[model samples]
Target: MKKIFENTQIAFALKSNNQLQLSYFLFKVMNSKLLVQLGTKILLLTLKLHLPVQNIIRKTIFSQFCGGVNEEDCLKVVDTLFTKEVSSVLDYAVEGKINEEEFDIAFVKTLKIIEFAKERQAIPFAVFKPTSFGRISLYEKITAKKILRDAEQEEWNRVVNRFDLVCQAAHQKDVPVLIDAEESWMQTAVDSLVLEMMRKYNTEKVIVYNTLQMYRYDRMEYLKKINQEAKQGAFYIGIKLVRGAYMEKENERAEENNYPSPICASKSETDENYNTALQYITENLEFFSLFAGTHNEISTYYLMELMQKKNIVANDFRIWFGQLYGMSDTISFNLAANGYNVAKYIPFGPVKEVIPYLIRRAQENTAVAGQTSRELEMIKKERSRRKQE
Candidate 1:
């Protein structure tokens, strides 16, 4: 069972000797919590001071994590993955914008990406964030049941229009689009909008996909209700399932608000919830399609085992495995090699703008027990095997 993820040669085939060394160095640095915290501050400060550190950042961590700063820049990365039978989920990684102009810009960029995906066999899905298309305040107010002023209503309309534009393009181009999940507070509005898009575009098939974060204690029940709604509406539901990325922030918010936390009681609880949701989806396979986004070896193998037990083919269109770029190469490449439908979440944006994303990645690696250690161990094993050759 472990051998599926043990083929480091295929995993590292995309990296050169020097690139491998740099990745090893980066992961080693990320393994230290103190260094990652200190280095993150310094990196942001230097960037704010207009220091010319982008080159160094680009060559090291950025090169490993991001596809590039723009769509054209990602061509080579997509091509390389296609050679190994892996598809790319092109993600516009820009974050932290509050203006309408920026939202419109990201919306246009997403449309262009959908159009780009229409022609590229290597690119299978396009992903964007709801916050990227509108103001957080608008979503928050809507979630909180606050009455919107006329001006605020206009702004919310614009956001809804932007979402429609992107989803419409995806539907027209026959490309699926993933709407990323966010904090639980604002997720109600996001869910409403994504379902509206699903009602519009998912009638024929699953063109609009919603991300489900299984770390939330209520999501398994939520999935059941969503599935029932989809069935009642006679529309297919597309889901990208993950264990969630904002556990600490979510718990902190719940504590600050003096409310019970929505997070699962333990990691084991989250894992069980995720597997249960997957089984539920499998049971109703005719009404749903799933993309399992995880780096956990046990979960990946469990999905494979589920598919096998259910007599599903290795390359079933209804099931997919995903990991982020620059990490979990072993899982991604090996899955693709074994004829599983697989893709990596390839993030791209300006180096400076993507710093937040990179910092979170580094912090996650450090905080998630044994994540960096496991990566380092695999990289060292690969390098050793190469040397022995």
Candidate 2:
């Protein structure tokens, strides 16, 4: 494919001069490892002390990385992105809730977003983390096959009910729901639950998407295994393929517990695994619909090449390209400009509630080798282009 991602004009078309400057500043800050570490500590401390810094955060990182404090607050962003032919996936970014009430709230919020997607052409999908619907420890316990006490079994049932309710609503509304992958230790339970949802709701079309963090070494085989299951069960498979977010944590836990790490041994291996999964899914489109959640331009181009070689159309409903809101605008916007299906994962929640998610975004940018630098480079180019204009 041509080097379409280099077109900064189309990429930053929606950003004002001020917004562009803010992006440049944010990436510049993220590019510094020591600054990110110190800033993360200070921000966490501020949040802990309830020090009146919400407004500052809301204006800076929160505004750049998130859509708004709630679903209603995200409509303007949804409409704005839709103007560029890019759709939105309204992700409720709140995390670490450990109670039944909080899980129910997440369930209701997901249902509401699915209904919103049903009504609006701009919002194409809804998303939630597995632990958001339940508890991480509960998922880990189930993954380990420990027998649940009556109370634990009851809690597990509620978790399953939450997943079913959200998937059922999405299916009824004809909206696809993407379930995010979490830590490897708890992911087996999530994968099983998501597969059950697929079997239940995806008999005719894909309505439930399970995310595969391709950084894990075994995901390609897992993908093939699920493909076999989907073939046998006569259901469609919806996948949101991502390189992953929890590498450091996964490696640390594996070392501490004296087990082999699940992550690919190196970034190149992870990249290869991700691209291989992309190729496999594209080749097996009869049973798979892919929502490739990536910011890597080469992987994006490789998928484009696969589509071309296989005679797949750019706008095929079975394929889509996604990037997070406020990151990788070049890939998201340029893909949309080329008539490809593109969606931005617009994370929204209260400023205080989304601090964890924002922190992860910061840490991810810091850890990913060239991600922040690439963002800085693109923003710099866009700014210079505008200055000349």
Candidate 3:
């Protein structure tokens, strides 16, 4: 990979104009009303039939968010980013599907990704959502205090087969796997699965990571307990944390279901716990591999500050920074430019299979945060700069 010719990561992290540029891009793409409308239309069509609309989707949302439909397809985009010294995490984004036959297919696809990662020098990590292989409702029932029937047990066995295949592959190939956090109700099941994987595969290298969503009021304590379990089990721990993407959904469901809301009291509270967690993890970096998944400028800067103050080396394998595949390019680009270990979570799947993801991203940006506006501002800035040239 060629060295970045423009602003480096530290420069981009340090500068005001760079922050503005980053904010601009996030707001624009996240806020693009027209693009959202078009995407909605395409998503609806996707439900009716498979439209050979790869080029259109590719140029629009896929270009912004996904890596590619498959490995060979991802090479050019991967190579382009490599030129800027940026790396990628392979994410096969198909979600919300499960059947014995279909689960086997996804299991195979996920294994192929691990194999592909070990074969490539550029790809450093991979992510998997367990729901992609099993029924979330089944997981919910199992996790809740509800007693499982024999049929549910049979179903869970199939799910376990699908999950074990992926984890076993990761163990064989020595690729780190991150299990994404899900809704609060199903999270316990996800956590259980992550623990089982860690117990089996994390004896030497941190082979599996579990995402902790700090927006939940309980996660800080939960992380502490999990860390304790890891120490007791004598296994390495891999933790990747984010502020969380499911706050409103979690709250809405909690209200409907008449359960206590799992969300933090305020955004401030979430941010505080998030920063504190980063500090705590960095201080104990020897015991854990910590990945901070954020687009928050302050959080990124604070981690760098902690690294310096604590005398932690930048080359430490336990530390990494990541943003989504399509969003937060400024953070991703600048961080990689500056030599901090960073990666973009590059998602890939058939267009039809990923509409749910697109819809959620749209809803996420549109909610009161002005996320789309930030993205739009950056795209407009880059476009205007090119125009002036």
Which prediction has more favorable lDDT, 2 or 3?
A: 2
Residue-by-residue lDDT tens digits, candidate 2, 143-254: 9999999999999999999999889889888999999998999999999999999999999999999999999999999999999999999999999999999999999999
What's the distance in Å from true for residue 171, model 3? 2.1
Give the Cα error of residue 43 in candidate 3, in Å.
3.7
Let me know the TM-score candidate 3 reaches against the reference structure: 0.88
TM-score against native, each model? 0.98, 0.99, 0.88
- TM-score-wise, the better of 1 and 3 is 1
Candidate that scores best on lDDT: 2
Which rank order by lDDT, best down to worst? 2, 1, 3
What is the per-residue lDDT of model 1 for residues 76-172, given as tens digits with 9 covering 90 to 100? 9999988999899888898889998999989999998998899998998999999999988889999998999999999999999999988999999
User: Which prediction has more favorable lDDT, 1 or 3?
Assistant: 1
Give the per-residue lDDT of model 3 (tens digit) for 139-190: 8997896888998888888887767777788888888888888888998988
| lDDT accuracy of residue 72 in candidate 3 | 73
Instruction: Name the runs in model 1 displaced over 4 angstroms.
Output: none
After superposition, candidate 2 runs with Cα above 4 Å error: none
